[model samples]
Target: MSLDSWAVPSNTGSMELTDTTPVHLIHVDPDVNMARFYGIELQPTLFGEVSVLRTWGRIGTNGQAMMVTYDDEAQAADALHELERQKRRRGYVPAGT
Candidate 1:
């Protein structure tokens, strides 16, 4: 995706900051030597849109990222929650947990 096209406007209007904190989840089991990580974050765009950034790959690697633009923060937040739930079902848990 080209962020160059999302030029910032002079007035950003009433844009409230939502949960921009990145959520990092990991799953590891020594028996099967399975170790993986999944991260999700919500970012505000210059064009007044919200972006959901997702990254997943093996632990200790740079991994891959995919950005999905949403019309608003609420929609982006919902998408983030849904992804978290799916990951949790797959044995993924918060990094510190």
Candidate 2:
């Protein structure tokens, strides 16, 4: 199967918000195997829900990258927050700087 066809869609008008204010896109670098995390609140049709999704990916030596979506917004936010707390306890620099 071609995995490239399963790539995440770009954020256009896919988000639904209670407020009219634009949501902030938080980019996080964990400094681990995964190069970075792109956090965005999205309303994806597949999931049929409005939530945040955390994506992590890495580019090869030649700069070719592949990303995998972790979870929906609610789950992603919770995971990210917990990760931050864990890093803090370990005295390590947290993700998202």
Candidate topping TM-score = 1
**Candidate 1 overall lDDT versus native:** 0.90
- Looking at model 1, residue 67 earns an lDDT score of 99
Query: Which stretch of 10 consecutive residues in model 2 shows the poorest summed lDDT?
Result: 19-28
What are the RMSD figures for all models against the true structure? 7.3, 12.0
User: Could you give me the TM-score of model 2 versus the true structure?
Assistant: 0.30
Model 2: per-residue Cα lDDT over 24-90, one tens digit each: 2223346754443333233333554444433333322233223234345565445446644554454
Model 1, 1-97: lDDT tens per residue?
Answer: 7776687555655355567888899999999999999999998888888999999999999999999999998899999999999999999999997
Q: Report the error of model 2 at residue 34, Å.
A: 20
The TM-scores of all predictions, comma-separated, are: 0.82, 0.30
Q: What would the TM-score be for candidate 1 when compared with the true structure? A: 0.82
lDDT of each: 0.90, 0.41
